[model samples]
Target: MSEPWTLHPDRALPADPTVRGIAREVYAATRDLSIVSMHGHVPVEWFAQDSSFGDPAQLFVVPDHYLTRMLVSQGETLPRLGVGSTETEAVEQDPREIWRRFCAGWQHFRGTPTRYWLEHAFVEIFGVTQRPSAATADAIYDQVAARIESPEFRPRALLDTFRIEVIATTDPAWASLEDHTRLAKDGYGDRVLPTFRPDPLLHVDRTTWREEIDLLGRAADVEIGSYETYLAALRVQRQRFVEAGARATDHGHLAADTTPLDDLEARRVFDAALAGAVTAAEAEAFSGHMLFQMAAMSTEDGLVMQLHPGVLRNHATAPFAAFGPDKGYDIPVVTEFTRSLRPILDAFGHHPAFRMIAFTVDEDVYSRELAPLAGVYPALRLGAPWWFLDAPDAMRRFRESATETAGFSNMSGFVDDTRAFCSIPARHDLARRVDAGYLARLVAEHRLDLDEATETAVDLAYRLPLAAYPAPR
Candidate 1:
């Protein structure tokens, strides 16, 4: 059996002591940098309520698609983990059993960052001293449960303790952001912010789309009938989010494609899309037009726009039918960002206020498309390699391929991008370690100096995210 370790020097530091010294120093320089989260799917209400967390299984397994997907991939049932409905229907009240099963299979995660992050979370958050297993599950659970019930473990306390300078949560555009507004009204700290994501507005065929669009119109106080009126309503909502303390807008699309259309043709296409009978060509055209308009709106309103395109959502139809949207079944299909994004880039690639962060399901395009695109365009920056590829190995691959072309400045710093709240510290710590390791390799090979590595590491861990996203006014 591979022995459990907290943080072995050999794993993250360079093998050679000289280079490892440099690595250790670089890690130290950035280790305490305040977290600046500009994009993520964490529930906004967490900050609104500022409640205490539950036990480990509910905190880790129930909310994270990353964790649940791995378990499901290994023939472990999601319901057994108490994530979705299927595993919960027959058996009831087995949170401890779920944690026990996860603990027993914890060895399956050996050497994976999930194991590292979970171990780190255990030590740092709950003060657990041993490896997780069926034998240790109940003890760890009771300990963590006790801590989470304490005032120090409440979400707000943890946020302050973690030294998170600013954290942004994604909310659907139709959402009133009343939670965020309420937080502001109560004179809570400005560290919690909202991101306006317009993904639901992208899929017109869903029954929920029309209702949501109408709700957005109501929120923005505009008519929803014509193309012009609909655009005005969306503009109004964007401004409202800004006034309510939004500094960014998020777009989750099937692709990064965008376009600008002439007035009549755009109106006709919009009419078709609004009626929910859009042809494939019309759907693409309308979405493309909306992307361009959203870019223009960003210029007008100063909200940084983020384009996280190319996810094949809910890849398993059966599970989707059985449970719901995010049950860990969504898979990344290969995506194209070159031709797909050419339309938008051709128009606003150099615009000053139209900032963008592009993510991909396709790592193959990192050098050929995204890096080159980000290298030249003042408006564009690369989002961290995401979803399945957010693993340590994949992160290293991203640095090796993209940094040569795009350089570190053209990349946004890491976003935990997690729904599981407790995992935030664990995830960010993993990124820092992984990034330091990558820099150590450069120093070992004589490609860069230790000072350059130190500055780059600090930027990657903290400062760059603030610079890339809007920083207040």
Candidate 2:
């Protein structure tokens, strides 16, 4: 009978009868609140063109690094899973075969957030009633393929069905944002916005730095002959993004250091980097200086600054050379934010116009560093548990660790931070359930009234994100 595949109405609620009842009520109050995905990596072209997604494998397996990485860990090759290669001669696998491999390895995803999200998509989105396995793989695939062919499964229609009020896509600083402009013309402008991501430009040690600089210059219509012109070009690009409805700037540095450098030293390092003579230490110092500069720019422009630090990207070199970045080998490192961010905090921590949300994969810092820092700094807020920590238990640990000091208001509401467009609603729903369980416990213990928990649930699910990353007027 395949265990009778079904989504329990109270799947993530507390097990205790009283707490589960309280959680059910809490969830019902906020379950329908429109999603505010203030930060994510979904490509804007899908929505701009209202593109119909392809088969099940193409829609779910190929673009999601989470699924691909897990399958790779189980000894399945990326190419077999339909992951495209950078090399020109690689062969593409059949979609059905790729999906079969995924389904055959489905048990590997048990107790994983990927499983939760996939199951949600299978049942709620595609109306699948059988558990995915080698036996059910083809049938499930055919069912989803049929559903995807419908007009209701189109990208724009799915967004509407998901009740997504506003979503932001991470875009390069040098991007033309033509897709976003087209969305605006297509009357979906206010619903989808861009977020400025300038990590490549910040790290001068990269071999592609020079080429990226030239592209930035072309994009901003400014000549970048010196450090002054480079900053000018970046400023112009940020203004362009602002005009296109960007409300936030996203930085993904390997560390959270934000020390500033004197202009003379900065210009010297910039010149060396341009000459391809920069050393590792110099590049790190310059990147830190740029982060401080970004804060200053945020203060002037009123765009919320987001820092997601301490990720060691591309842990393996072979896959990177064969494929490309974001192939799911990024690992987390221990992060210390208190002293590292003192320089920026001292400068703009209290600035009214400057708002910064900090995200991390390191849980040790949740209460020890981030919560305390956000607790005192008026300009700082703690971003939701992200990346590897977006799972249910980790989300609960985040609330237990950070809520006492930072409170619900100092936390940015759940940000999906996904490239998989179909996983947005699932991810948000999981967060809402986890939060409801947390709040329900408080009510069960008589620590909070039901009314207060209901309001907080709605705020965490919807209102906080809009306030944290307001749309540019």
How many clashing pairs does model 2 include? 0
Off by over 4 Å in 2: 1-4, 85-89
Q: Report the number of the highest-lDDT candidate.
A: 2
How well is each residue in 1-473 modelled by candidate 2, as lDDT tens digits? 44658899998778999999999999999999999999999988889888688888989998898998999899987778888654544645689999999999999999999999999989998889998999999999999999999989898988789999989999999999999999999888889999999999999999889999999999999999999999999999999999999999999999999999999999999999999999999999999999999999998888899999999999988777777898748899999899889999999999988999999999999999999999999999999998999999999999999999999899899999998988999999999999999999999889899999999999999989999997554
Per-candidate Cα lDDT values, in order, are: 0.79, 0.92
lDDT of 1 by residue, 1-473 (tens): 55543556545555677777777887888788888877777788878898866666778777777777777777887667775566436432577788788887787887676776787788877788777888888888888778878888877787788787788898888788889887888765377888888877765655577888888888888878988898888888888788778888888787677767888988887688776677877777677678888888887888888887778778887677766778737767677888877776777777776788888868899998899999998989998877777778888889998999999999988987777677777778778877888887788788988889988999999988888887435
Stretches off by above 4 angstroms in model 1 are 1-5, 86-88
For model 2, what is the error of residue 259's alpha carbon versus the real structure, in angstroms, after optimal superposition? 0.3
Counting clashing residue pairs in each candidate, in order, gives 1, 0
**Model 2 superposed RMSD (Cα):** 1.3
Question: Ten-residue segment with the worst summed lDDT in candidate 2?
Answer: 84-93
lDDT of 1: 0.79
